[model samples]
Target: MIRTLLALNGALIRGALAFVLTTQEDIEVVAEVERAEDIGTALRTQRPDVAVADVNLFGAGVLSAGGASSGPPPVLVLVDPRRPKVLGDALRARCQRLGFLGSDVAPERVVEAVRRLAHGGSVVDADLVVAALNRDNPLTAREVEVLEIAAEGWPVVEIASKLSLSSGTVRNHLCRIAGKTGARTRIEAVRIARERGWI
Candidate 1:
């Protein structure tokens, strides 16, 4: 049997997921949580083999495991099709499984994603995957590092010092990043870079 934990911010969505999972003979909904804060505890106590998380739960820092104990359960993030960037970044940063589903996805797709994740396979919707790849702007390794430091509110001089690069070199990187992302300023560039998983 596939034991699973469900963590969703919406009550209606939670109900839908529970209803769908219960229909699968091989799947068991061991626990349900309304907030990301409860995810760690639920994972530990329930010991579910798979965790279904909402992409919006990113605000709770659940993906970062901020409040969770060590060795949390493997996670499968369910993303809204309109916001693929947020989910993709979480997947890249944390190495978690991802499955995209809009608020209007049929119950069958949700069930399929759950089953795939329980068996250790990622399940991204075809359209969502295409959108993510097409929307993504490639960034070089140095550009990403510079953007990460800049996003932390470090001044250009400070960032340059930390990275052992000249201020001019850092500024050049920022300009190139801004041009590539169509951003008007360093702050905007950083924001775009982060949204695109460049940092």
Candidate 2:
């Protein structure tokens, strides 16, 4: 049996995880924690084979400085499907095991993900993979810089002033970016580009 540690921000998500694991004959939830501060203690006490952590726990920061310890169990992150590539890149950069799940995934899929991860396998939902790939259109350095600022809900006029470009030029660049990414709006283009590591 794969003894698992459940670390999630929401009580509902935690309860759902526990219910799913209980249904699996070869999986057991050995411990539960809600914060990064509690992770070490839980790992030490639970001695679990795998830890399933929600991406919300990490926020915008990279993994904690001493996040990975020799005695700590392997971690598999559950992340939003729309931002899988961004989360995947962060996990990969840390040399950590990861699994991506849409917020709406069923309990059976979560159990299967946990099982696969416990066995040293990586899992990313199929739809998320397609979305990541589809968002991979390359953007120029200048275009990406502009898009990053624009993504913060900035106006074209403001973006032009900040980047020392004419408003028309900013609009033109945004149009090109949207076309390349098959996005109808600048916000969608920026989100897709950022998620795919293009910006």
lDDT leader: 2
lDDT of each: 0.73, 0.74
* TM-score for each predicted model, relative to the true structure: 0.60, 0.66
Tens-digit lDDT string for candidate 1 (1-199): 8888888888887988898899889999998899867876776667776677777664353454422244445566766665557656665655444455554578787788778876777776677677677665577889888888988899999999999999999999988888888999888987666555455
Per-residue lDDT tens digits for candidate 2, residues 123-144, read 8777766666676547888888
Q: Least accurate stretch of 10 residues (summed lDDT) in model 1?
A: 59-68
Give stretches of model 2 more than 4 Å off: 33-41, 44-47, 56-69, 96-106, 119-134, 178-199
Error of 1 at 78 (Å): 1.1
**Index of the highest-TM-score prediction:** 2
